[model samples]
Structures are given as structure tokens and as C-alpha cells.
Target: MSDPVDRPGASGVPEAVATPRSRWRIQIIWLVPLIAVLIGGWLAAKAIVERGPTVTISFETGEGLEAGKTKIKFKNVDIGVVKSVALSSDHRRVIATAELTREASPLLVDDTRFWMVRPRISGGTVSGIGTLLTGSFIGMDVGNSTKPRHDYTGLEIPPVFASGVPGREFILKGADMGSLDVGSPIYYRRLQVGQITSYQLDPDGKGVTMHVFVNSPYDKYVRADSRFWQASGVDVSLDATGVKVNTESLVAILIGGLAFETPDDAADDAEAAAKTQFVLFHDRAEAMRRHDRIVDTYALVFKESVRGLAVGAPVDFLGIVVGEVVAINTRYDPVAKQFSIPVEIHLFPERFTSRYTKGDQGAGGRLTADRQKLAQTLVDHGLRAQLRTGNLLTGQLYVAVDFFPNAPKGKLDWSANPPELPTAPGGLQSLQESVTSLLAKLNQIPFGGIGKGAQKTLTDADSLLRQLRTDVVPQARDTLAAAQTALNSANGALQPDSALSQSTSDAMTELARTASAFRSLADYLERHPEALIRGKQEDKK
Candidate 1:
């Protein structure tokens, strides 16, 4: 080799031996793999530190979810993203794998609820429609508990109180669930304040119980004696004040809803506790009937039929409603064996009576004593309960309490479970009885005999008139003609140029001539011997 350091030895060129320079001789290809491994390891460590709990959710459908795209949200804020979606083992549902951010780690808990938010229509209301443009996503509803967890079953139905919708929940029980459903609006007065969350038939099968939510400020209006009514559709009433129309709102008219009002002595400022049960009425009028909460029960035994009178008929005191009929039953006396209607009514004196009284006793005692005293006074002054016609067209009946001084006397019975009040006949019943009596008297009249006698008398009068017209009229006409001829003769005799009028004038002239001769004789005699005194006055002429 010519020079070892400068050798082209493989091709037979000269090799040169010179000082060998040491080099940093690691392969860059191997370095690339090493640097990639270090970088990947660091990334893996960072990912491990940052990764939140992985949750797998089973859904009925994978309708709106896409791997690496779909995100979980709470109150419109993003918290996690879907990593993968696959069919469940049984192929019945979709199992979604989601990677939650570390910040959302605490959301997984026992009561934490999850559900897919999508456009849905319920109770004539459109909701979640905003998701149509934004694409569907998972919704996480935070729970009430503080316990940290990592697994949860998603809700099929949306929650009523979403994230921060401030409100309290209550249950309403009614005889029937009429046009009410989930998401039905709850109204205070006529405003849309809250919604009906859920409902179910009462376990005892007595009624339907609905779970409702009353939102923030409006919830404070509900009180212990607040009246809730189904303010749905149109309510038209024809009463003494003519036709009346009542509706809560246009929304309530279209889709059914509930409305509430503080009626009696319940507080308005203090809120009723959550889950407090209330009775739901069919309409506002029905709810108002129970405004006076306290009831003083009384019984009235009516001898007449209690037909057309329902249990809810208004019990009025001098045209003002003071109570409602609770029940109507028949009782038979052992001795008389007569069945009489015993009407039980709840008399709410609180409607017209105040809690404070003359004495310093507690309200309860004062109310009791006042009621007793008033009852005794009423009984003494001939107070009685009677039925009256409320609607003449429908013949609907109502209970009326009034003083009847002319009523047959009866004593009150306070020892009974429901204190017994004296009763008079219903106004309608009395009217019917009077009409029946009149009909009976009418039936007793000899109508056929009267008609025959009237016909005979009419015929006799007709015959008499005919006789007068034919014979008597002619004879009277002849007599009147004779009298008229006599009157004409008398008129002719009194005429200015008639023979009788000439005779009378001649007689008057002869009398005047005789008088003149007598005057001449008297004048001669007076000249001689004051002849026969009175005759001398004619001499001056």
C-alpha cells in the first residue's frame, strides 16, 4: 500500500497512511428513530397526565354522533368529545366512548344525567329545535350530590330543570289528567312562568298526580291555599250578569295549561316547600269555591225531591255563596218510615267572618264561639236553609239560607255530627206544587156543562134580538111616525101666518078695545064722583 491514509485500496489505487480524524459517527437514520421515540414518550406522558376519565355511554341510536367530532355539552358549554362509537355486543344499541376533559372529571356521578339533545315536539310545544343547525350533541345534567364518580346511565327524556333553571318542584293531584302533559305550561295569572315536568296516575287509583316546576320569582306567589285550575280552552258562562267569557292566555287556549292564584288566608311572600301536593281543579270557578279553607259542616233534611241539585251546587246566604253542598243522602225515620233527603254542606264562615273576635281568646276559640253564638241567634230569628232556582232555563237548583219568620217553626239540632239546620221547601218545588194545585182545580171545573149553558144562553139572546128586529122594530117605527105627525101639526099651529095664530091676535085686539072703553067710562065717573078710584089712572092718556 503506497500510503495507508490515502488508499483507494479496493480499486487498486494507492493507499496513504496518515493521521486518522475521529468523527461523531452515529447514524442519522438511527438517530431519527431515537429522537422520535423520545418525543413520542414525552407526548404519551403529557397525554396521560391530561386525560380525564373515559366514559362509555349506551344509547338507543347513534343518530347524530360522529367519532372525533361530536362533543358533550352542559348549558351550551363544551366539556368532552366523542372518541369512538360502535355497536353494542348484542347489536341492540350504540356504545359511545367519550374522552372528557380533565375539567369535566367531576361530572361523572351517581345522579349525573346524560342524554342526546335533538329537535323534539311535545305538548304542542317545539323544543331543542336549535340543535338542528348546530348538529345534535350529548347533554350532561349535573346532579344534586357531591360524591365523585365515573359512570352513569343516560336519561331517555329531557330534564325539566335544566342546569340552572331556578325553580321549585311541586306535585298536583286531580280527579283526572285532562289535556295535561310533560312540558305543559304553568301560569301565574296569565303569564307563562313554568312548565309541567312529568305526571302519573296516583298509585291508589284515585287521581292523576302531576309533577310541576314553578320558575324563580313566580314560584314565590304560590301559597298553602293557592288555587290551581286547568285554564284550557274557552269558558263561557251565562249567569245573572249575562254571557261571560274567560280565558287565561292565547297559549293556554291553544294548548292546555295550569293557572294558580292565592285565594284565602295563605301567605304570598313565603314559598311553599318543594313537592307540596295541591288539588287541581277543572276551572277557576271551581277552584274559587274552595277559597275559604275552613269548613263548618251542617245538615238539612228536605221533604221534597232534591232533583236537579248536584253536590257542588252553591249554598247561598241571601244571594251570596257561603258554601257548597258536599253530599246528598236519604234518611228514613223508624216511626214515620218517610224517606227525606239529608243534604250535607260545608259552610265556610271564613269567607264572611274575620279571624279576630270581640274577646282575647285564640283565633280558633273565638271562631268557634262566634259560630255557635251566630248559629243560636240565627235559629232564634227563624233562620232556615232552603233550595232556590238558580237557572230558570236549566232549572238548576242552589241552596239558600235566609230568615223565614213566616215559616213553620222548628228547632235546630247541634248534637248531630253535622249540625242540623231547619229547611223549607225549595222555591222551584213550591212553584211546581202551586202549578199542580191550579191544574187540579182546573180539572175539577164542569167545563162541558159550562160550555153547554153558555151556548144555550147565547142562542136565547140571539132569538130575542131576531124577534126585536122583525116585529117589535116595525111596530115602534109606526108609533114614532104617528108622534112625528102630531109634532108637525103642533108646529103648524104655532106658525106666524096660521089660522090659530090669527085667532090669538084678534082676541088680543078685542081685549085692548074693551079696556079703552072702560077707561073712558072711568074718566067720566072720576070727574063726577071720583068714580071707583083705581080706574081714573087711564084719564091722562
Candidate 2:
């Protein structure tokens, strides 16, 4: 090929050597495009190696989510960003696709939790205030599982407590949720130690099951016999004892809360395990009350009014309260044709036995037989139930079971459903009966007849007095006047200057003169004879 080219080039100057065109050459313009392509390929391969795992989170609403704008955070540090937000095929939820960094890849586990960070106020707590100034972001709570997950359901409500917080969870079974919500404080001796986490209606629908978390130190205090009660507000009670007010704390008063305490008697009980189940009492009184294992129900039939007596009234034995009235009913006896009041009372025999004896009370059957025999013996010995006024101001009545030695003899009706116990008249009712009997006796007296007889006698006495004043008084006055005139004449005749008194004195003097003359004549005649003249001998002397 070189010789032919040389021969063909003969037309040209043979001396001029025509060299073949150069096969290859470098151009400056092409180098620029080649370098650009090589750099672009390298960058794409690096991006594929460094990219993190993608996750999709379903939310009920997409309120604060944005594509290419919203960020995913863990512990306030950005770990990922939302790539897109789209509705699910069913349109029931919003699906957000987020791209996390390579470092966060291992954190995407089965139990990882996510929630939106926004301003919230609940259960006496304020959170996420900083989110108001900054924007809302996706919050992540790392899980403790090795298995990874690419799909998750976001929580609508934020957790009351964060993961890794030193605490324990417990279950409380309650009749109802009494003013309680998530984040309500749980107190121990009025100190906040925990908070309620969640609650749900029981499957049986009989009660609610609540979940609560207690911090580390306080969690140790929870024991097997620990008592729990609702301490939502001030528990104010006005009863026979007096007015009582109970509360946990001011926070409990504002929101709602629960309180727990280990009873002093049960201080040695074993510590409760995590997720322990407990019964939530309505109040502390019920929670603290000692449970009675043996209960005896009896019916007391009273023949009097139970006006002031009410259900729940204490049934007192001697000075001790042994039971309470469970029910009160009016019953009519068709056979006897009489009405009576039957009060059903639940008596705790253990209360009576524990005061005198200790140890196991007895087996159920034997215990029941012993109680029946004891009750019969007591009834035979004049043990009776009576109603008495407990509070005069409140007109509250209570059952008083006592020994009434003089009470009429009666027997218990053991065949009755709740074995009937003998009842005596109420104290006030006895007093009323005595007063009524006295009034009835007084009413039986014939006061009208007595009054009529008295009136007749008084009329007769008045007539007799009038007759004396009209007839006897005038006759007696006339006789008295005649007698007074005669007395005056006799007095005048007996006076010293009267003529009869002077003539009597003169006659006495003339009789004395005559006797002297006679004595002188006799003396002269007998002067010679002798003694007859003794009167004359004095003259001789």
C-alpha cells in the first residue's frame, strides 16, 4: 500500500515525500465532556452505597406532614427526612415515606415508636412548647429488638413517659374510671411517684383495667397487700362519727389521681412484681377495712315503727359494732293477720370471736352449727334486739342487741330464710306505751258522774243555809231579847240603895234589942234560984 501511494503521487513532485495522514490525535474540547461523564458515574455509585433504608408510617391524619420539608428526629437530632406523603389505597390513612440516614438503619426495629411533636397540655403536664416556635417534627423512640421493620403505625397521643425511664408498670382493676385520664398523677403519701399510662374497658364490660407506671424508688414500696383507692377530689363524709375530709394533694384536687399505701399490719408482705394486678377501692376506708371471711345474716322482726332506722345502720352487740343493716322490709303475715318489719342484718361472727379467742375460728359447717347453737342459747337467756336512737340531732337509729332479762319469752324461727331473731320493743316505743297506758287509765275514770254528784250536794247545802237564815235566825233573836230584859230588872233590884235592902237591915237590929230585954227580965226572976241568972252575975261583977 505504501509503494502504490508513492507511485500515485508521481504527479506531484517526486522529491516531495507525502506522508500518510496521522491515524490518531487528542482534542482539548473532548477532554472536558469525558471528565464530566466520569465524575457523574462515580457520584451515582457513591449515592447508591450511602443511601439509608426507607420506611413508611401510616397516620390517621396528615396534619403536619410535608414532602421534602418535614424531618425525622431522635433525641432532638435530625436522623431522616420525609420523602413523600400519599393516601393509602383505602383512603383511610395517610402514608408518609421517610428516608433515614445510614447510621439510623439499625434502629428501625419491630418495636420502634414514632409520634408527632406538637404543643400539648394534658394530665397537669405541659410539653412540646418548643415545637410552637420551631415546626412540628416526627419523633422516634428506638426499639430494643434485632428484627427490622419497614412499616409502622404512628401514635396519635404522645407517651406519658419516655422509654428507658426507670420504672415499673402495674394493673388496677376498678369499678369505673373515676375522673382519671392518661398522665394522672399517682401518689404515695401525697408525693407524686408515678402516673397513669393507659386504660381500657374490660372485655366482660364489668370494670376498667388501668395501667400505671411507678418510678424506681417508689416502685419498691408496692407490696402484695398494698391498697389502692381513688383520690380524685376531697372525700367529705358526714356520718354518725362526724364530718371527715380526706385528700391526697392539690394536684389531685385540680385534676384526678390515685393513691396507694401498704397497711402497717401488712408491712412484711412480699414485694409485688411488675405488672401486678390490684383491686382499686372506691375510697380509703373500704381499702383499709379488714375483710371478714364469715358472715351470718339474720332477720329481726319488729312489731313497731322503724321511722328513724335506715339501711346501713350499725348493728351493735353490747358496745361493739358486729354488723350492719343490709335491708329493711315490711311484711304481712297472712296466717296471723299482722304486719311486721323485717330487718336483714349481716353479722360478722369473727368480730365477736376474735375479741375473746384467737387461732382458726373453725370449719364452715361446724362454725355455722356452733353459731346456731350459741344464738339459740343466747335467745333462751333473754338476748334480744332493740332499736335505739344513735344521733338525736340527726334522728339516726341503730339496732341494739342486748340482754333483756325481763323481756317476754320468745323463740327464734329457725325455719325462716334468714333465721329470725327475737326483738324487744324500742326504747322510745316502750316509753310511749307507758305514757299511752297511763292516759288510757285516766280516760277510763267517770269524771262526769262525780261532777254531777258534787254539784247536787252543793245545791242541798246552799238550800239548808238559806232556810236557817230565814226562819231559825229570827226566832232565836226574839228569845234572846226577852231574856236580856229580865236580866236587867234583877240587876236593878239587887242594888245597895234599894228599899228592900234597908228594911232587912232594920229588922235585924230590932230583933237584937228584944233579945236583950228578955234576958234582963229572966235574970231578975232567977236571981234567987241560981244558974238561970248567970247572965245577971256579969252585971254584979
Candidate 3:
């Protein structure tokens, strides 16, 4: 180097000196590599920290989802990325491996649900327009429940939107689902409180079961004594008057819904224990009671067809819906050579007992005077089967209950004689039989003889009318002509130039002059026409 420049070193002696240009060159070479190393390390650490757990989400279809484009979002914010997608072994589902970031790990709860957000159209809502632009993605609902969880199976079909309500699960067995729809509101004591969640046929496919989710607060009001009914849909009816019913509100009338009602004797303790996840129908105690009731129902058997009996058809103590038809079955009566359909009716005496009775038994199991009154009502107005028409055209018949004043007032004597004829014949079958009998009676009438008699009567009437027109009318006309001829001759004789006319005129003039003298005579004659015959009553004048 030239003259060892005075660049200071650690040893203060002029060691192998470097120029400013060379030093700058050395810094550029060494610092560039170090900074590159630092940048690489930083990138590696970021990648490791951001990397998340790999979860395989199974879906029935991947029509709108993409591997790299689709993201896993929690609450509308992206928290994971889908790395790859492949079909499962069964090929029924698309298994997508998604990476959930470490930051989002805490949000993964046991009850968290994952569903793919796709465009859907339902009753009134059309959602997922954003997916059209950025592509559809899997949505994750991370919950805080402590329950255990497993791999999520994303629904191909969107889950029905149901409000998470605190209620007990009730299984309404043998319910009709075609009679129910979503948003079909549920009623509690006639007050709308919730809606039906869903309805599906039981796995065994014997009956339909309705899944009704009652919203919080109101859900607690349901009790074991609660009864459900199909509250919506058009119920057309016709009687002696023509067709009549309330058929407005087209949607409400068409889409039937379920309603819940509780009896007055519902247990409060049972009502309070009802929580978010409580199951009402599965309780052993409640099940036992239902079983006992079923057993009680089977004890009695009727000996006739209760065809066309409906689900809510009443079993009246008097004239009320104290109970309903639970079921109907047909069994062959070998002696009668006919099928006898027995209707299983359910009764809740607690509902009507209070309304009609009074007095109480003091601390004893025995009933009081009120019980006697109730017994009398049961004896006089106990359940009676009456004929009812179901459909006019179909001629279906049903058994109904009514308290007719003429009905016998005593306990039903099962051993006594049955009615000789079907009770009163009020149903369609009875009407048909009556119409047939009337037609038969009409057929027996001698229509040919009546027709011949009617023809003879008409012929006689025609002959009488012709005789009146030919003989009587002609004779009357001849008499009128003779009178006209006599009047015409008299008019001709009174002509001005005739001799009779001159003599008549002179006589008329003389009569006019003597009219004053004849006035008294005329008045006297008018007063007494017979006086002229008796000679003028001059003495009386």
C-alpha cells in the first residue's frame, strides 16, 4: 500500500491500511450476506408460528369449494386455509384437509360445527352471494361447550336454521309431517311462542315423528300433561247448510303446524327441571304413566265399526272433548261373519271433573258429595257412540259422541240387548239406504196408469173448452145480434123526414110544454110505481 495511510487500528500502529473506497466495498459484501441470513430465519419462524393443525373436513359434495381458493372462516373471518381435497374411500364424501392457525385453536370447541357456506334458496331467504365472487368456503362455528367432539362432517345440504332454544326434547310419535312446515308457529295456550324444527319418519318407517323446538322461557311452560295438535290447514266441512269453513290466508291454511297445550294439573316441579337439553318424553316416570294409560285403554272393547274415526275425534262425558280417539283396529267376529272395528279412546277425567263437581273429602281417600254428582253425570251422560258422516262423495262413516235428551239415563248395560237397528241411521250409509228405499217405493208406483189417466183428463178438458167455444159462444153471439137489429130499426123509425118522426116530434113538443104539469105525476110515479095501478091517490095529495 502507498505510504501506509493513517487509518487507526486497534494496535495504533499503521497496520495494513485500507482506503475508504475499499472499506466501503468490504462492508457491502459482508453485510449483505448477514442480512439475507436474518431475513431467511425470520421468514422460517413466521411460517412455523402461523402453521396450524390439519383437520380433515368431510363433505358430501365439493361443487363450489376449491382447494387453494376456499378458506375456513369463523364468524365471517378467515382463520384457516384448505390445503388439498380428495374423495373418501366410499366416494360419497370429499375430504378436505384444512390448516387451522394456532391463533384460532382456542376457538375450537366440542360443540363447534362446520358447514360449507353455499348459495341456498328457501321459503324467503336467498343467501351466499359473496361466494359467487370469492368462491364458496367451509364455515366453522366454534362453541364453548365442554362436550367431547370429533372430526366434523360438513353437511352437503345446509342445516335447517333453528334458534338454539332451551327446551326438553319431545317425540310426538305417529304425527303427520306432510301437515307441518318450517316457521309453522307453535302455540301455547293459544299464544304463539315457537316453531317446528323438523319432521321425519322413524327409522323403522312405521310412523312419523315431529321434532319441535320450543324457544327459551316458553319451553319451560310445557309439561307432561301437554297435548299437541295439528293447528293449521284447511278443514273443509259440509252439513245441512252447504260447504262452510274459514279458507282465507292461503299460506297459513295450506301449511299446517303443530300446537302445544298444557292441562291445569301439570306438575310444577317437572316443569322447572326442564332445561336447555332436557328430554321430556324419555323420562321413565312419565313413560310409565303413559304405559298405564295405554293398558287402561285396552281393557274395554266395542263390538262395531268405528270407521272414519279421526285423530282428535272427541270422547265426550257429556258433550265435550274430554278425550280423543287414540287408535282404531279391525277384528273379525266369527259368529257375526263381519269385521268389527274397535276404536281406542283416551280420556282425561281431571280436565272436566273440576268444572262440574264441588265438595271435598276431608283428608280421606274417599270422595265427598261432589263425587256423587260426578258419578251421576257419568251415569246419565257417559260416552255414547253416535253416527257421523265423514265425506259425502266417499260415503265414509264415523262414530261420534253426543248427549241426546232421549238417550237412556243409566250405566251402559254391556250384557243387555244391542240396538235392533244401527242407532238412528245418521251417517252417509244410513242416508244412502234411505235414498235407496225411497227410490224403490217410487219404482213401485203405476206410472203407466197415471200417464193414461192424465192423457184422458187432458182430452176431456180439451173437449169442454171446444164445446164452450162452439155452442155457448155462438148462442150468446146470436142473442146479441137480435138486440142490435131491434135497436137499428127503432133508430130508423125516429129519422127526421119520416111520418113517425114528425108525429113523435109533435108529441115530444106537447110533452115538453106539459112537463111542468107532468113533473108531479112523474115524481109521484117514481116514488110509488104501484100507485098508478091503485088509481091516483088524490085524497092523500
Candidate 4:
């Protein structure tokens, strides 16, 4: 705190001193703009760094899309926004340009999927309802591919299921698509477990192929021996057991669906790999049929009408289904001048044979020679095939193979391409024959001659009754009058009065004396007769 002392110098009058000011000093007012500029620069750099890539999506139509309004979302989270919407050069499609967040950049790969989401109803499902209020948006499904892409195709229809869902895909080949469509339910034991993703007609135009997805953990149930069938509507069947109604679910009955089941006795329960191919049977019954490698094909020639029998009818051994009728044809026996129905059947011997193996086969998947011999032996023992009524109400018939001990002896006609198995008349046919024979016997009766003879007998009886009324009746009347007269005379004579009464009294007195004398004589005779033999014994008193 000391004050500076100035000493008197050479110029005492020049005491004033000059102090220098730095030119580099900034004004306080300028700092405000300078700080503002620095912050603005940093924000610009951040915007550049966070900016994502722009991509174009081609769609069939831009029905609900708008530039700068529609958003691209992944799992309901906004990931991008549409920057522009325009038509393609050919005017056949629409192209939408969108900007996605930087974080989503990695997901835009070769297989990434994009689609417009809006309220939609398909395959018995109602979805995207939220879009009805919030407006439509683009849905994105990330791909696993590493290759990046800038241009992509947008799906017109929303996927039945999203990517990353735990499941396995499968392909079903069938004669027809039936009632199936995208998003159609796939059922397991009547429970919905997945959906059909897509379908296409085969290149050769012979059949259809469908792709389906079964979600976890149900997917694990699909096995190599699994059978898939169309369970779209109410399946009604009439058989010997009576009418049966089956349906997978109410949904399936309305919108069509498919079902799969692995047989309990399936030789293989190994899980089927993804995209494994399977046959799509028309119905559960066909799907459930055993696929036996060793089959014995035979032809059964039936002499009677086969009106109720149909192809695909079950061939039964006892109560078990051992085969099915494959083909039915009519053949003419020129030598015998007769027409017969030849039914071709495929019999799976394994169905009836214990522990039969598929390897035990002869040429053309037929029964082995030893097995054929065994079949011949069975035929020798009266094994026969007969037509049987399966459903009386429906008049449906099926083939029944059984051992009829009384069946006539016959041999297998091996000369025929498909060996002919001996056949016996069906019970119905036998009944018809009996009825026909009885009718024939009834027709042979001499009913006309019997009617004439009865008429003659009736006429004769009528004549006899007329004669009795004319002659016998008058004679009987006269006889009755005479009898009445005789009765009157008897009444007068029997009266208890006059001389007859007096005479009767006297006669009675005389008869009593005579009776007493006779009695005495009888006693004497009795005693004398006894005495004659040995005199009467008197009692000693």
C-alpha cells in the first residue's frame, strides 16, 4: 500500500507518462455470438453423424401411404419415416422413399421385408386394428443376411407370422390346395399351432405346393411319419359304426385349415427337419392309412351285382382294415358267356401278419414267394373274400376277407396278372337267392285247380242244405206233432185215481207176501247148499 515517488529528471516540466493498451482484447458483447456459433457447429456435426441411409421400397400400390406422414416401424417402434411417395416409371407400381434411424441401418439386408400395415381380415384373423386409428405405416422385418441393400420390394399382404419366431417351416405337396389360403391355421390335435404362409401351383401344373410354419414348442412334434390332411370343414362320414361328424375347430370349419398327426405306432418319431416335404392327404382317414411297402395285390371276380361297392372302399380282415379297393373293372368271360366284376385290392399282409418286415417282398412290391404260398394254403383252408354291407342306411359296401370254413374249395388263379383270390357269395346275395328260389316255388303251386275244386265243394254243400230245408224239415214237423199226441195219452193213463190205483195196491200186498216166502226159501236154500257141502254150523250159546 505504498505510493510511488517520482524523482525529478532532466525535464522537470515533462512529468506526464504514456501507458500502452493491448490490441488483442475482445469486447464482452462479442463473446455471446462466438459461443452461440460454437454450439451451432457442434449440433450440425451431430445431425450429420446421426443421419441414416435413404432407401426406396417398391409396392404394388400406395393405397395408404403419404409423403412425410407414413412411418416405418419395427415391432411397433418407429424406426423411420417416409420422405417421398411416387409411381414407378412404368406406372404399374409405387415406390416409396424412407429415411431410417442410424441404429436400423444394419438391419437393411438383402432379405429384409417391408410391407404396409392397415386393418386387415384374412384366414379367420383380424389384425392391424391399431392402424385404423393411427393411420397406416410401413412394417419392417429384419433379415439375417449380411449384404446391405438400398432398394427393396414391399409385400402387398402382411405376413401371417413374423421373422425370428421360433418354429420350423414345411412344404406340403397335394393334388389341390383345397380350402387353404395364406394365414390359414395349421392344427395339431385340434389345437391351432401355426399358419400357412404361402402356396403355389406346381410348375408342371399337376399339383399344388404349400408352405406352412408351425411355432414352437409344437413344432417339435412334427416327425418323419407325421400325416397332414385338410381339416377345413365339417367332415361327415357314414360307415358301419354310423354317422360321424368331425371338425378341427370352429375357426377351421369357417375359414379352412390343415392338421397333422403322427401315428402312435409310427416306426419313426424322429423330428422332421425344416422344410421337410410331406404329402397332403385329402382327409384324415386316407392320411392315417398304413403305408406298407410289401403289398399283395389280388383280383376278386364277383358273380353277383356289385352295385354298392366303390373304389377306395375299405378291405377288412376280421374287424381290422387290412387294405382298400384300388380299382373296379368289368370283365367278360367269352368262353362262359358271362360278365363278372373284378375288384383290384391292395392287401397289406403286415397288417395281419405278426412282425412282418418291409424287406420281405417279391417282384413289384408283392408278397414273397413263401408268403404267396402261405396265402395259397389259406385259400386251401377256405379263406375267401366277400362283399359285405358296411352301412345299411347308406347302402355302402366294402370287401371283407375272412375264413369261411364251409366255403367251397378253390385255387388261386395265378395265371391272371393280379392273382385271383377265391370269393364266396355275400350274405345279402345268399339271402336274395333264397328269396328268389322261394318265389319260384310259390309260382309253381296249382292255385287255379285248387280254386275250382273248392268251388265244387261249396256248390255241393249248398245243394244238400236246400234239400234238407224242402223235405227233411216237413217230415220232422209231422214227427214232432205225433210225439206231442203220445205224450198227452201217457199223462192221462198215469193219473193216481180209479180202478188202476186199487188194483195197484192189491198187487203190491200180494207181491210183498211172495217176496217174504221167497226170502225164507232163499235162506233155507243157502243153509241146505252149505249143509250139502258140510251141514250148517249152529252157534253154541
Global Cα RMSD, each model: 9.9, 14.4, 14.4, 11.0
Predicted candidate 1 versus true structure: per-residue lDDT over 280-340, tens digit per residue: 9998888886465467999999999777899889899876788899999999998997889
Tens digits of per-residue lDDT, candidate 4, 2-44, equal 3334445544566668879889989999999999999999999
Decreasing lDDT order of the candidates: 4, 2, 1, 3
Better of 2 and 4 by TM-score: 2
Q: After superposing candidate 3 on the true structure, give the runs of residues whose Cα lies further than 4 Å from its correct spot.
A: 1-39, 147-150, 159-174, 179-199, 209-295, 298-356, 360-541
Q: Which lDDT value does model 4 have at 400?
A: 93
lDDT against the true structure, each candidate: 0.84, 0.89, 0.62, 0.90
Q: Output the lDDT of residue 2, model 2.
A: 60
Best by lDDT: 4
User: Taking the tens digit of each residue's C-alpha lDDT, what string does model 3 give over 206-225?
Assistant: 76765666776787776655
Clashing pairs in 2: none
Which of the two candidates, 2 or 4, achieves a greater lDDT against the reference? 4
Expressed as tens digits, the lDDT of each residue in 1-541 for candidate 2 is 4665557556665465788876687778999999999999999988899999999999999988999988999999999999999999999999999999999999999999999988988889988898887788999998778899989999998888878889799999999998998999999999999999989999999999999999998999999999999999998989999999888988899889999999888845998999999999989888987756678899998998899899989999989898999999999999999999999999887666665444554644455559877788788999999999999999989999999999888787778889998899998889999999999999999999999999999999999999989998999899899999999887877778877677877888999999999898777776556655453355554
For every model shown, what is its TM-score relative to the native structure?
Answer: 0.63, 0.64, 0.52, 0.62
- What are the clashing pairs of model 4? 531-535
In terms of TM-score, the best-performing candidate is: 2
